[model samples]
Target: AAAGWPLSELFDRQFASWLDLDPALDATNRVPSILNGGLGKISPVYWGACLGAAAAIDLYGLRKKRSDPDYFPGKLGFDPLGLYPSTTTGKRRMELAEIKNGRLAMIAITGFAFQEFVQQYAVVDQTPLLFKPVSDVVETYGSIGGYGM
Candidate 1:
């Protein structure tokens, strides 16, 4: 969910603007590299907040545990539907699902890397379904040969 949220946000016009990405201007065979430009300027604020959030969560967990000796620190018992089973088989299923989700997220990140390496454009621009048809995109930006490769 974490990786997917950022990926989706990159395609969102307003969110991408907030992240200092201008789809219209960024549509070119420009290599992705270390932080620079407007993104570089705002990156510290975004990452700093993420670090602060993590610290806050840790402090809250510690305070809760200290206040209640029997308190479970990690799990919040968040299953509203009570679907989480206590059985061993159910636990294994949950674990497998988590593993699959993580692997899928990794694959998605890898795909983004390769797409940038070849397409050399914003993911939103490279995606045909976003701004144009597949045929149009392939014509305008050839598959695997988009950046004169």
Candidate 2:
């Protein structure tokens, strides 16, 4: 599939896609601190909270499924060891997971955005030099900056 493809054209298109990779690239450039800023603020407490929320949603879904009438006989609506299998045809054991976890994903995403926003303007950016080149960090700010390459 590499036949007759002009290097320049391919390069241009690829470059465009690269720009899309970090729409916030421009923003990161504008605000070096925030973009490069360390998110160490994502403390253990914050991690515990995210993990707790995700776990709570998982547990709630497990309980709901237990009473869902779809659970296998003699199995508390779980696959094994009181744990729900993420995938199964028997009554869609994880349907609740999709619903509950989907909501958690949304809430968590929103929370992350809010945290970044506040950190960008109000908090001091403490980005580590070693981490500045990380793809995720670059993407986070690049998308915000509308990085068009």
Candidate 3:
């Protein structure tokens, strides 16, 4: 049991590392805000674009995995948990798919957040002029031009 403990720890670390590198697992914070906010100051069109991009990323991962299951680590045989006596079976493949799907879900969630962010913060036209450059006025009108005029 003692010897098996170290192996288990190592496997856990590897699994975590692999998951981190998986593109499907990557989740940006931007998606959630848009979904929650639902187009305030920002444009709805931009939010839709962001959501579309996220969907594309997710689809890319699925397509890549389908094309080559071995594209990811632990595909052939490298059981992290040692729960299975052998990793060469349909069950192991299903387990891998489950893990991948979990990551995909996270990606999707974050993508939604990103869409929200776009809607909340993205600038539309320059009509309102939230914060124009004071320097422009200073330069055009001159710092002391008011007194002279």
Among these predicted structures, which one has the highest TM-score?
Answer: 1
Q: Which regions of candidate 3 fall more than 4 Å away from where they truly are?
A: 1-39, 73-149
**Where is the poorest 10-residue window by lDDT in model 1?**
29-38
TM-scores for all candidates: the values are 0.54, 0.29, 0.26
Off by over 4 Å in 2: 1-22, 29-89, 121-149
Q: Measured by TM-score, how close is model 3 to the native structure?
A: 0.26
Error of 3 at 14 (Å): 44
What shift in Å separates residue 27 of candidate 2 from its native position after superposition? 2.3
Candidate-wise lDDT, in order: 0.58, 0.45, 0.46
- Candidate 1 per-residue lDDT, tens place, 10-74, comes to 54456657877744223342223332122443457767999999998888888888887756645
Worst 10 residues of 2 by lDDT: 1-10
RMSD to truth, every model: 5.5, 16.4, 19.6
Local accuracy of candidate 2 as per-residue lDDT tens digits, 11-94: 433564777632222232222223344434234676799899988877777787667875433343345564554555733646
Q: What value of lDDT does candidate 1 attain over all alpha carbons?
A: 0.58
